[model samples]
Target: MTYEPELPANSSPADAASSTHKPLHHKPVAKAIHPLNQAANAKWVPINKSFITLTRIILKSALERFGLVNLAITLRCVTQQGYRHLILVNDDRDIQIAAVGRVEEFIISTEMPMTPPAERLSAAEAVTFPVDFQGQRLGYLVALVRNPRVDPGDEIQDHPSASDIKYRLNRVAEEMVGVIKRYQTRYRAIYVYGDQCYWIGNSAALRQLDQRIDTLASSALPILIRGNKGAGKIIAARALHCERHTEIVPFIESGCHEWEEDAATSILQALFAYAKGGTLFLRSVDKLSGENLRVLQAFCTQRTLEKTTKGHAESVDIIFSLSRRDAELPASLQRWLSINTVDLYLPDLRERQEDIRDLTRFFIRECALGKEFDLTESAWQQLEAFPWTDNVEGLKRLIVQLSARAEHPLVDRPLLEGLMVSLD
Candidate 1:
């Protein structure tokens, strides 16, 4: 997994994490790594946002009822270099305290807490209550007691017995598991291919685009597609091609920069030939040099010219794209383009904000390969607020890291903040 720049010494969480196909409890783990000591190899995924939030809500209610001050949830992570460590997932803030001594001792100690000295525990008032489930370790729990029992070793009466605490923790953990399941169900993807990604949502913008594609798919008219980077212009072109021909056909993609003045003739000839009875998508016509623009101008004008003059093939569906940010093409060029091709403006992320959640779910499904994933509401807000300057392309890149960084399926605000801050 990738990491951001080393977080400051005092601010980061200790290392530990988890994953599973069917309750994938990881293998053995190293005790704990110093905040400064994030190993070169650590297999980690962040806990889901919902999972973490639900966990905190339930765990806090249950544990605090009996006066426990803090806890640490450690999950196992393995490195590509063959190292193992029980990376800490929940931070001190989430669990409510450092419990530093207890966690560190639990991680490193082979012996049980009863076999250890007072200093091995946190503040000597904390005791390590540990559990292991389906081979995954529940490292320790710390209960801070202010008053001493009359005969402390004989039978402590203040807090619930260890069995009662275990019962409560078990109930809380089970509840969190339900949260994880819900997340997985909610975010599952219906469309995964980049070409089909924009079609995954049901927003009005998407529905209109879908309708437009249907109306124009078989018309064989030259067309223009406009969007920011990764906004799925090429996907639009592909959709047109697929709708027109049920069978697979050639779809050649080239940028306007490739339309050299020196070779415009040969390149156009080659592209149309290769795309015969198929589609040729040329992007960024606005990027063409003035001389090159004249060549495209002549070409489009001919496409609009009478069949009495030499003209390009009727079978080739040639499409062009321009950045929506670009100023409009010159009047004469726009006139011919308007006469010969339909203008199709792609909606920007801002315009399509309503579809962000669905698209993110689909992309995460693609990245996580069906592993359950959940993000907190704030994390979802962070995603929506992101400029997505690179559009769908940038969103996918961010999700790949987001999926791998969490040891569990849940992605919370802090985990996302760490990643987003690094992007700046």
Candidate 2:
């Protein structure tokens, strides 16, 4: 049985009038019957059973664990629309109404249409928005306004007021699309390497980083990720490798500062062997000695030459991370980086302050498990005001600590202030 909202016994005048007119194509079906009754009806038994089973699966799955249903309901409420339909299109181009809001007694077609209706509704003049993610159209949201004004066919359009309505509708649709796409994307737990996942957020910096990773992932050139300490450069590097290479390749990581001059060459040789047909991530390369830097440069040059001449399919892709802004390398090393590497800069937590709330929520989910705490307005202001010197790592640590001592359901100003003072 398809679930829909309940309607009042004494309907409004508008509802009575709408009920009088039959829909353009199909007659309105009987008020949604109980699942058992739907099963008893021979014609609808298979379809109804399948739909119920699918809904139960989705409800239990991780896809619906997020706020997809809540988002649809919220969008419908915010728009003040009497009817809202969210349709999900699968890989095989099959479309199904995944969710609906305020559409209790409406006509629903039994058969799937051959093609989805064009973005605009012609009969009733409703606007449709495509829920797109990463250039792929996953589904659409159609919101129908009650008693919509008819569009007159004219050579020149003269409706000035329609523009404002269109703008508001477009804005709401955009917001709904964003919410859906964010939940659908695997940004929270992207596979990075063996037994590790990168937590990529929805901040603008990370969005740009995702784009850069897509652009440079398949290239043979070196990649240099620059950021402050604890700014997730290493995670970004690993995510890039996971995204670009189709085959499972080894990820060999080393800290350049850990290598002494005498052992640098031997260590690099061993790393090269381990990193064949895969990625080699060098952390804190800015701290390497001049001799060690030269050794790296020579290795890179040799690999580049060998790849060009021998067509080695097992060449290693080098990725370097620089934590300090003022760190300098030798002129030759700098020149090589400039010529052979793609530089990606990750902004500090202070730069993307808007992401603090989302990061806090993520940490709460991770650290608190079932127990949750709400942050008061003043507490949020305090968090925003403080400079995150250690970036996301520091924020996560603070959240974990706060969740441990959360006396009240809400984290208020006094509690946050005390924690901040203690940390200082």
Candidate 3:
């Protein structure tokens, strides 16, 4: 059954005995939260289940400050509202008749919504809160109570009951909008000269490559990254351009196949002008002809005598990418563009099996936001068992399709089986 908070809608007869209830920041009883502890900012105060004496001490202090004497306070479980009770403490900080009254009201509202008031009240009194988290502040949550006789456990109860709490949560969500925003940057090391590098994984190969990149970024040597097709060569090139020590430079990306004789000349001239004190990434270095390679070599090796139409030559850095398939080219060609080659052996999705589960979970969470569906364990298992030929791209499409078809709260085995059958 759905649950709710137990609390009074209006001040009870006992409330007439209390005065103000302002929380004080400084007193002999006031203690400081640990420095750098973000948890202290949380609304719910932390207390151990066995710390009865500490609980009493804090409660007594709050009551004295609130000028409470004869008022009866109550604490009761919020259930659907929370995992624990809203600890209602009187102005005098005593948890007494109010707790019983609130718990009874909650039971009446949830279990016997249509029952007569006398029968519901009797049925409610039998239910009680086993634990309390709100401490003495439960009484202050008056804004959450609706019925004139109802007493709530905490102010942040379920919807309608905790309107104030919903407002607070909304405020928090709004303030956090741009705080976690992500951005992209591309840079080249002094050695490679390019940028566009954001990768996630804790593999040993990647760590070693990161170290190499750091060292290379500190030097002026030419660097080459050799990888397989779609192996993130462009990503590496962009990362090289975004080095911290270098000036914000233009990153020129040009493929060898995109150049004819005149086009290549014009592009090179334009690049030289734009790439002064920056980086130029030759996306597929393997596509350059022998004559063009020689010309590129001359351009890189030369010192600037004066600025030409293409600007100063000595300040620009060059990075090249070649696929491993192209790396096995004629020995004569290797000599033409040979420099410090860094092999990037990108693992196939099958080879990185350990990442599949985590990656799938991430993709599901990303795709399911604002959706009513969640994938069942069996459905996820089916996805995990399938052999993906297109790697991450294929997995993304499959997830999108599955999410589009989901109607229930979870994409169960039946849904997945049907999807798999259709695909096959």
Candidate 4:
């Protein structure tokens, strides 16, 4: 259920792609996001006023004008045939990106300004301006003014700062477009390395994990990444490899459960050779049989690259990812994995709930394909309330589900149960 926006299809920003690993920026980031953020910007509706910080600030400044009490702007979706509503009032309420109709309703309810300035401003206390860019009517800017006692005239011309409001607002609309462009390019501080090895989130847990990843990437020690059946462990390994190398390096992942008794040693040796001078991720090694585990332990202890026929002492970083607690792993394998090894923990979605919003935004932007779609605040409330025990991967799946069911752009509270969420 991808809803089209009134904007052109976004292209990847040239500066978004990075070769090395980077930590997420805690400060305001530059106008550089990888394809991920650029992609999300299409579906990236502003959830709060701080979204387009500079634009909102300038618009708020306009609100500081004496006569004006409310300001609303409707932006024509660039990719599709629709509009987006933005509102700024002289209050502390942070508004979300609303639909075209939503803004119209608010304007009508308050008798605020709307588009196509009514012919002959008689007894009118409001002004409406078309937000135009490059001859395109992007949307409308409406400002509702309370009659100040200074002027008894109902006409806008009677206000001392009428012309000033118009001039400053027009300037604001101009700056709005520029600021939006900047935001669309770089709204997130995500660190990405290809599709498989990028981390997203602002959670302390994630940041701490990142510090650990950074610390371990340089070491030659074997790593045991234990997570509670969630996501990002392998991705963590990929990030580690990325931090360890500037050039493209082989990153191989094989499940330990797939190893058979007859061919376990052969498969192990093959994986090592294939990922020489790179990283090999072994998933769920706790599932390996005791005999196969011993096979691995012996092979890892004895074999250096120099001992083999094709060996030159080539180093391969081995990372083991399992979905169990350290205590749960077989004692023998655990001893082998723990020997002078780094133990990295991947927190599941439940532990990193704080990052859910950003994760949802990222996934929506990726899946929505620049369409003007929405999950309303109420819809979001329900979504946030659901415990996604499956982790970030589960949240992604749910967003994808919602995207699939959207008949139009908006997914509101009433539709949540029937349309997307399914506990069974």
Candidate 5:
């Protein structure tokens, strides 16, 4: 929900939005505030700052900067009245735009069942848009309207018809494609790899890690990414594959403990097939049994072979992930592979309380796409004070649960207190 920037020209948004869980079909969104609008609405015209200068150049090269396409998409969807507008291009037929307006209506109505029938119907009428951004027919729009209520003599005037939305969306899509092309040509500063925006305190350990990932990506060594659960190990692995030296192939990952020893061959075969000339991420390698251990060991020994074997390609890179940094790897395997290690340890939400607000802002915007949910100052304070043992994932769960149950659009301290007390 909290978007840092866009992906490179070679990557698709679907690839960028990759999650293990099936992603619910939701409307595409743009940024909360456009850089263009922010410049226009500033109180005083002072000397331009560096970010502002970059923003200006980015705007000038909107069609070229990969990040700008995402920014532009974010800006459009978060607009006051825009109901889930998608940027579609005639060139890209793989993109499919979901209808979020109806889904939002269903969620709202279901959440507020106690409202008077008249008011409920009135509320429904205002939000129901009849147009959608459908990427078809050199591209156009489609929509679903349920029981449009019209007064005796009144007419549905000034409403955005399907064609109108199609025309506007098509233009935006074309603009986005142009923006993507431009980014590829100019703006060398936009570093695609080792360029992740994250929340980390000014710790020497964390700073060292930031530098290490960049260096490690250049070498074709065995990498072992260690991190706590929910610490974004998968994200790190994906970032590694996107580096310059690696060929763009499907990322193959498997948890060592999840499969039994007998099932190792089938799993390895599947992984070897998926990661053909790409990266193979063995998550929780410490849990592998006697059988799977040998299979891995054999692959590493193949380095001594003079000729490239049928399946053993030099381009195939291997990465491992473990939960603990100091945990001992099985001694037999340790001698064979030198895991160019990266430890991704983030402080828990309670430990880094200052970041809760930023994280909350991110979660709020994400939930708001379906329903209106606001957090009072006191509510934020309550959240900041709580012990978030589960870190970011736990906070997300709480917000989603609260958003589903809250009576008002805005979440106040009282609502949070009531929920917390009930849990206690």
Candidate 6:
């Protein structure tokens, strides 16, 4: 087992020291200098200059950056030539060995088969820094010195004092914490809607919707989505499937209008065959013909029966999207839904008017492609007051038109009004 640096909230210094099999201060001496460290020393680059360069790289690769690797590399380049091991622990209690200097075997042999405690632990051999953002603890960063000749008991005789090492490690840990917080903030704002990707709204309704989607994603039950046209039913379904399964599970989609003819059986058979061990999304399921309805009913019944006895049989999960304007579902379909499916009702844009500003900002950002723009108060009011018949879909189209026609970075009331008149 890999050893972590965390300790219990109530753990004393004695308990923390005993958790690790051996003290962290002891490390095997280096036979030869590492090439990277040697090159770094030759240039004699200032620590602040190297830190600034590393920060720029982290910002540019924000989305793809791994915190552990970035922190490890930065610490190794800035510190003195000694064996250094960097360990990072995440909020989920997952431990990552970010970097191991020349003496990897010595570090592994000393720290393996130990579990991290819940609280922070420190020893004379190593230092542990708690990484926090806005007062919330994110993780712990531990750095161990690898020089075996350095005496833990007699620190005054050591050439590079332990105080110097601690100070450098702490500074590097602070920079790493900032990068992690920024990455998390960006991830929460980003969202995808069908082919168009935009930032998500922060309204209460949107938060609830996200929570509901998360709960439904992990279950095997059928899903019945009811919403107005262009209210994002299909997007929700796709998001649910993507979150639940990691592998490339085939997602087969078909419109019920396509099955209005007599060839419904063949189309459904092909769809079912394609969707085995995956998901089948039926668009406007209420428009299905009587024959198609019977076919679906029988299919659901057979699958239900098979699931009862043969637990390991491959089954297709059905997701039905229906417009609120459509007629009530047939009694048979209703029974199947009631017995083995969850119903999700999406609110139209008009119902959640508070989200208009955030949704507009997201669309504007997508259009600008990182260019900054400002919307006037009156322009924002105009957007929030409008009755969005097409829900989020209509709002997106309007933003695209505004982006195309606006001559300046400032989107004022008059410019917005002029565009609205032209679109009308």
Task: Tell me the whole-model lDDT of each prediction, alpha carbons only.
Answer: 0.53, 0.54, 0.43, 0.56, 0.45, 0.53
TM-score for candidate 4, residues paired by index: 0.52
Q: Model 6, residue 158: displacement in angstroms?
A: 50
**Model 4 ranges with Cα > 4 A deviation:** 1-197, 304-313, 325-327, 418-424
Worst 10 residues of 6 by lDDT: 26-35
- Candidate 4 clashing pairs, residues 3+ apart or interchain: 5-79, 5-80, 6-77, 6-78, 6-79, 6-80, 7-78, 7-79, 40-365, 306-313
Best by TM-score: 2
| Cα lDDT of model 5 by residue, 258-334, tens digit | 65544444445445544556677788887778776787666555632522454435346677877554558777656
Candidate 6, 1-424: lDDT as tens digits: 1112233354457745554543332222111111122111111122343234444443223212221111222222222255222222222332222222231211111123222222212355444555554344434445444333433443333344566655655655555543332222222213211245322443446546655766787666778888887677766666555545433355566666655444444445556555666677877877877776777777677776776665322677778888663448889766766787788777778767877886787788887566677788888888888777788878888888887777787889987777666434
Query: How many backbone collisions does model 1 have?
Result: 19
The better candidate by lDDT, 1 or 3, is 1
Residue 89, candidate 1: Cα error in Å is: 52
Candidate 3 per-residue lDDT, tens place, 1-424, comes to: 1111111234344522321231211112111111222221222221223222223333344334332221112333333233333322333543343443333222211112324345223422222122222232232111112222343432333433244433442332221110111012211121223222334333334434444555565554566777655345665665565542223345556666554432333345555545556676776667777666666666555523232334433366667777553467657657654553444344444555555555565567667666646677787677767665555556666667777888787778877777665444
Query: In model 3, what lDDT does residue 364 have?
Result: 70
Model 2 TM-score relative to the real fold: 0.59
The C-alpha stretches of model 2 lying farther than 4 A from their native spots are: 1-120, 123-197, 310-312, 330-332, 422-424
lDDT tens digits by residue: candidate 1, 1-424: 1111111233223311111112221221111111222121111222444344444554556545555534444333333333332333334323422332222331222223333345335554554454443234534444433234422453445556657666655654444333332222222111111123324444557656766766776554678787778777866776665555433345566676644443443345455545555567887888777776776667655544533353333456677888664447788767766787787777767567877887788778889766778899999999888777777777777888888787777789888888876554
> TM-scores for all candidates?
0.49, 0.59, 0.43, 0.52, 0.47, 0.53
In candidate 2, list every pair of residues with a backbone clash.
none
* Cα lDDT for residue 418, candidate 2: 78
Pick the winner on lDDT between candidates 3 and 4. 4
Worst 10 residues of 4 by lDDT: 1-10
Q: What is the TM-score of candidate 3? A: 0.43
Clashing residue pairs in candidate 6, if any? 6-117, 7-117, 7-118, 7-119
Candidate 2 on 136-227: residue-level lDDT in tens? Answer: 45344343332223323323233324444355445444543333332222222232222223443455565565556667776778889888
lDDT of 2: 0.54
Better by TM-score, candidate 4 or 3: 4
Q: Candidate 4 on 1-424: residue-level lDDT in tens?
A: 1111111123123312320122222222111112323223223334333443334555666676534656666654322135333322211222333422344321221123433234423346667777653244556777766454433453444454678778866865765554443232232222233342345554657656766776787665678888765567766766666556533455577777665554454456556656666667888878878877787777666654343544323767777777664448656666667774678888777677667777888788888767657778887877777777677767777777777767788878776666444642
